[model samples]
Target: MDDVTRFLAEQQYVELTTFRRSGAGVPTPVWVAPDGDDLLVVTVDGTGKTKRLAHTDRVELRPCSVRGEVAPEAPRYAGRARVERDAASVARVKRAIGAKYGWWYRALTVVEPVLERLPGRRPRAAVVITDVVPLDS
Candidate 1:
């Protein structure tokens, strides 16, 4: 595994910073798991992070609090992110997340089917972060 991927995979929460069209970075806390050398993040299909990705793949990532707060000393990494909406990819990410997060994730999985019945619930997509490297300090 790449150092960046291994490091972030061990973290409980990750602050995924996606870039706006204007180049501003929007950071969101997300559950992530390691998929080989890449980092996998699952999110709603139409979320801002996914929308932003349509315009740019450039992103920064850092270990952070569950609420998205990055500590002063956290290491940051830069990478290319791609949102995958295919069933296989989505399923793979969900499995990875469920394995890492355990019971809480299992509970979510149980509830997910019911939630999907909602009138307009967005489908989940998997965001794969690749080519990651530590940002220069």
Candidate 2:
């Protein structure tokens, strides 16, 4: 988690690719924040991603070019992810976001609740972690 934590803290955005039920894949643009040793994202339940995450706890998060552009051939970094339910953990994640992105965090605080109440918005917390199994190099 150390390397991941550092990578995420420095990267502003990541392309989150999740598995779809139809044996396909879904790629989404997400604004991520650090959550201790994991990356945190707040999304509503019952969405396509929510369901997919429920079925499989794996996802790929790739750090894009700092210029805010990505090529079609970018290779994503892979990891396993899961839903986090603890209140303390949630608060920690929120604080991390606030610390990293100041003004944006303040702005989100105002709209977060409204977004949470939107239809199909479940406000679930996701934590992506690297697999412990070593890769052959």
Candidate 3:
């Protein structure tokens, strides 16, 4: 595995910063899994990050706490992200995330169907980030 993949795989959460139209950084904590040399993150289809990603593929990732606090010594990784809306692709990403996250992931899968039925609760989708480059800290 490359340095970026290896470094990220050890962390439980990543601060995924997507850009707004005005070039503002909006960072959110997300669960991530290694997909070959790339990274996969699952998020609600209607989230701001998802919408932002549609207009821009640029993204930055770094190790962070579960609440989105950036680690002081973590290196930033730059990459291009694309949404995966296909069922098969999303399922594949979900499996990888579930395997990495274990019981918590499994529990979420159990509740997701019910959660999706609520008003304004859109289905979840996966974002695949590739061509990751570690930026100098």
Candidate 4:
């Protein structure tokens, strides 16, 4: 694995900053799984981050605490984000998340279908990030 991929794969959380059409950044701490040279983040459909991605692919990422706190010296990277909505790809990402996160993610997968039936409870999808490049912190 490359330095960036190795570093990222070791992280439990990453602050994913997705850009809005108005040029504002909305950062959220997310579970990330390395897929070859790329990264995948699974999130609920119709979220602000996913919605922003439909407008543009611009994104930034950095290691962060589970609560979304970024360390002062955390390295940052820029990349393009794509929302993957197809069933096969989303299923693959869910498996990746379950492998990395174990019980919590796996449990959610079991209940997700039922939960998604609730009002405003959307289905999950994967956000694939590519062309990652290190940026000055």
Which candidate leads the pack in lDDT? 1
TM-score attained by model 4: 0.92
RMSD to the hidden true structure, all candidates = 0.9, 3.7, 1.4, 1.5
Cα lDDT of all candidates, in order? 0.93, 0.65, 0.88, 0.88
Q: State in Å the error of residue 106, model 4.
A: 1.7
- Model 4 alpha-carbon drift over 4 Å, by segment: none
**Per-residue lDDT value at 102 in model 1:** 96
The most accurate candidate by TM-score is 1
Candidate 1 displacement at residue 24 in angstroms: 0.5
For candidate 4, write residues 1-137 as lDDT tens digits: 57887788789999999997889899999999887887888888899998999999999999999999999989999999899999998988887778889998777678667887898777888899888889984
Better of 1 and 4 by TM-score: 1
TM-score per prediction, in order, is: 0.96, 0.72, 0.92, 0.92
Number of clashes in model 1? 0
Q: Model 3: how large is the Cα RMSD against the reference?
A: 1.4
> Which is better, 1 or 2, measured by lDDT?
1
Write candidate 2's Cα lDDT for 17-117 as tens digits: 68976667687766677655667765544567777888887777666654445566554576777766566656666777678888987886887777768
lDDT of 1 at 72: 91
How many pairs in model 2 have backbone atoms within 3 A of each other, for residues 3 or more apart or on separate chains, i.e. clashes? 4
The TM-score obtained by model 1 is 0.96
lDDT of 2 at 88: 67
